[model samples]
Target: MSKTCLIVDDSSVIRKVSRHILESLGFEVTDAENGQEGLEKCDENMTDLILLDWNMPVMNGIEFIKALRARSDGSSPKVVFCTTENDVEHIREAMSAGADEYVMKPFDHETLQIKLKLIGFD
Candidate 1:
């Protein structure tokens, strides 16, 4: 089966950009505008990976990761925080919260593809 991915970001442009990129890499994509919607979607579908954005209107990426890690399943989506948060502290916190990977924003298509491949998702 084709791997599925969830793109969670508040910006429509970001979501669309990520969806197009993942689709080109043969991933089936689902999307949500914020962490609340993302969590709901996760419950509805077990995604192979999640491309999450920090600083959203509803719940943020960090909050999402915390809740996801609290689940009884003991495993959540292989999440990659795809955001503009370049601060070391934020990155460290995301890592501590159980994100599988973190990618800073302003990423090119090649960089995104490389990260996905490194995670064995591409």
Candidate 2:
């Protein structure tokens, strides 16, 4: 079966763009508007990978990741933070919070592919 991916971002544009890129890469993509919705999706069916955003209405990426990692099946999905937070502190924070990889905002298809490759997903 094809691999599954969940994208959690507040921006519709980002979600649309990411969905297209991930679909092109052969990942069955599902998207949520925020962390809470993402968690709901996860509870229904654990995805193989998650592309997360740092900021959102309900919950943020860090909060979602921590909650996800707390679950028994949480460690199964590779979490990648896709956000505008490019500073060293944010990057370190994300890694510490259980993100497998990081991608800056406004990423292109090639950049996403590279990030996924780094996580052995591409």
Cα-based TM-score, every candidate: 0.94, 0.98
**How accurate locally, in lDDT, is each candidate?**
0.87, 0.95
Candidate no. 1 TM-score? 0.94
Clashing pairs in 1: none
Which digits, one per residue and each the tens of the lDDT, describe model 2 over residues 4-72? 999999999999999999999999999999999999999999999999999999899999999999999
Residue-wise lDDT of candidate 1 within 1-122, one digit each (tens)? Answer: 99899999999999988898889889899999999999898888869889989899979999998988888752746889987879999989998988888888877788888888787775
Off by over 4 Å in 1: none
RMSD of 2: 0.6
